[model samples]
Target: MADRDSLIADFLSRTAWAGARRAPLAGDASNRRYERLTDPATGRTAVLMDAPPVKGEDVRPFVRIAQFLRGAGLSAPEIFAEDTVYGFLLLEDLGDDLFARVLERRPDLENSLYEAGIDVLAALHAVDPPDLPSYDPALMSELAALAFDKYRSGVVGDANDGIRAEFVARFRQLLEHAATPERPVLIQRDYHAENLLWLPERSGPARVGLLDFQDAMLGHPAYDLVSLLQDARRDVPPAIETAMIDRFVTRTGADRAAFLPAYAVLGAQRNLRILGVFARLGMEHGKPHYVDLIPRVWRLLQHDLDHPALDPVATLLRAALPEPTPDNLQRLKRQ
Candidate 1:
């Protein structure tokens, strides 16, 4: 704890947050760390992001996406200051009411909140602005590959090799289900129960504060919808999911018949990817709590497999993947 505090202090000192009264904000799996600081000059609260440059991740992408979202008039975190070299940034505080906190405090409000969320997603997907970049299929494939590399191959036991094979084979087929030319939109890959926040100060969809948007991209409209509806961490009610999907299709002017299969496949794909991520986070990252989320996500995959609209893709998942069994049962239990 002391070491982390020292690191935070040193990071703030060398970056834009120097001389501010810095305190740690909860950090995420990414290398970024955030702190709440008092801006000495303005005497206002500021959000400090410690984005150390290491590995393949860079801070510039975060800055770039923030700029793009802001240009689109999306409610993104505002950059208050920056240190080009060490890659620390001072941003405006969105608020403490992350969707997670809101869910915890007012579980009953989910239906209304999700309705607003779909509206935000509709707005984001509707934009074809010149500044935003695309999230091509190549990136989607790579992200999906993480499941095979990190979770299925490494975490699933040798006894369940066939079960592992089933998932991988089906995962490939699932990828094929939603494979399409890129669409233009701001896609926050990790949009889910945690990233969307409630801001009563604002109205309707704008009332939701967006976060962890550095990975935002121009991708399939299905991507963000799947991320929101088939969330691994929480069970979004089927009725609500159905209503919201209908609303999104209407709101975004997407063809209902043409889009349903795409949405289902993408949702299944998102759920499956999270399964692997949860396993990887457990075994490799030593964050085992994520393992508990695996079964729920798998259930979602199964749901997609059963979706009549997604029969082609569902057939693939069913064919490539074996029925659940003790061989797979023990593996599932291990998670």
Candidate 2:
């Protein structure tokens, strides 16, 4: 703790705002932490990102992506100073108007905010993404399998070995069918309402400020779109979701036939992963509120499974995992 405090002090002392007043900022699921620092003399504020390397956190990806987004004329935070050795960054504070917060205060702005987010995705997909890991079928299937391994097993106990194997095979096939897209684009793996900021005064895609993008990867463009529209934490109106889908398809000239199936498959994969993640957070990490969100995630998963292309995988999953009823949710929470 002493070393960390000293490092933060040294990092700030070297900057022009030497004695900034620092206050805690909300953190994400990762090991990283953030503080809002206010320069007393100038009354200007910046965000201090504390990503300690010892906890397997690195700031390089964030730095690289911030530069990339800014260069591309997007609204990623500007880096003012960085101490890579200790993994501390002083960043331009993008302000408190996160899209989620804005929506909570002004429901009327929901349509514009969501549309701006969609436009950001469309603009980002149009560019050639930086070199990153491929979100391939093998990887996607592995991630989705977490649902069975953690949530199903923890909530309903283990399944028969034969059934598990069959489920794995069916799930992998569905992922392969969806992941192999003709035009893969850079996917901000966590592009959702919570990670997006509403910068309405700005024009075009820049009207949306990007956050929490260290996990960006090379994947089908539909992956990020699904992440935004099918958010587990918030209920996006179905009409807005449909309209945005139409807008993206028309704007990008994407084949509706191909894109819709890919969207469904990726949505299923992502929601499945969330089920496992939420379960793990509750059971292993003592964060039980995440368990409350499973039913919602399950509903989203079922919606994706309704797609004809996902029938085989959906059948296997429905047979394997028990319905997420009140009793089942209670069992999961108990874990």
Candidate 3:
């Protein structure tokens, strides 16, 4: 802890923010931490990102992606200074106008905010994505299994090795069949409301400030779209969700037939993964509040499963996992 404090002090000093007032900012699930640094004389503020290397966190991806997004004319934060050795970055503070916060204060702006969010995806999918890791079926399937291995197993106890094998085989087969995209695009793996900022002052896609994109990958465009519309943290109105989908399809000229199935498949995969993640967070990580969101995620999962294309995966999951009943949720939370 002393070393971390010293490193932060050195980083700020080198960045010419030695006398700034630093206040803690809420952190996400990762090991990274952030601070809002205010210059006393100038009263200007910047964000300090501290991703310590010892915790397996790296600032390089965030730096690289920030440059890419800015070059692409998006509203990623501007990099001011970086200390890659200690994993600290001083960035232009994008302010706190996060989509979730804005909507909470002004429900009337919900539709327009969501439209901008969808437009950002449309613009992103229209271009050739940067070189990144592939979000392929094999990798996706492996991630999806976390639900069964961590969440489900935590709830119902471990399944025998043979049953687990069958479960994985069925899951992978269904995902492989449904993941056919005519042209894959860069997917901001966590493109939900929480990660998006409402920068109405900026123009076009730039009005939507992007955040938490270090895990961007090459994948079907529908993956990020699904993430935005089927958010686990907030209830997106069905009409707004439908309008955004139509807008994206129109703007990108995506084949509705192909895109819809891909959307459903990816949605199912993502929501299922979240179920496992939330369960693991509660059971293994001792963050029990995450369990409260499982019912909402399960509803989204069921919605995706309603698509005929995902019947096999849905059937298997339905048979294997318990419903998010009060009792079941209570039991999982206690774990």
Best by TM-score: 3
Q: What TM-score would each prediction reach against the true structure?
A: 0.82, 0.96, 0.97
Q: Rate the local accuracy (lDDT) of all candidates.
A: 0.70, 0.87, 0.87
Evaluated against the true structure, the overall lDDT of model 2 is 0.87
| Residue-level lDDT tens digits of model 3 in 1-335 | 55989989988887778999999998888789999999999999999999999999889989998898888889999999998888999999999999999999999999999889888888887778788988988788878777778777877787445655676787678767777566778888999889999988889999998999999888988899999999999999999989999999998998898778888989988998899899888887778888999999999999999999887767777887878888878777787
RMSD of each: 4.1, 1.5, 1.4
Decoy 3 TM-score against native = 0.97
Query: 1 or 2, which is superior by TM-score?
Result: 2
Local lDDT at 13 for model 3: 82
**True-structure lDDT of candidate 1:** 0.70
- Stronger candidate by TM-score (2 vs 3): 3
* Lowest-sum lDDT 10-residue window in model 2: 159-168
Off by over 4 Å in 2: 159-161
Q: Find the 10 residues in a row with the least total lDDT in model 1.
A: 321-330
Clashes of each: 1, 0, 0
What is candidate 1's TM-score against the reference? 0.82
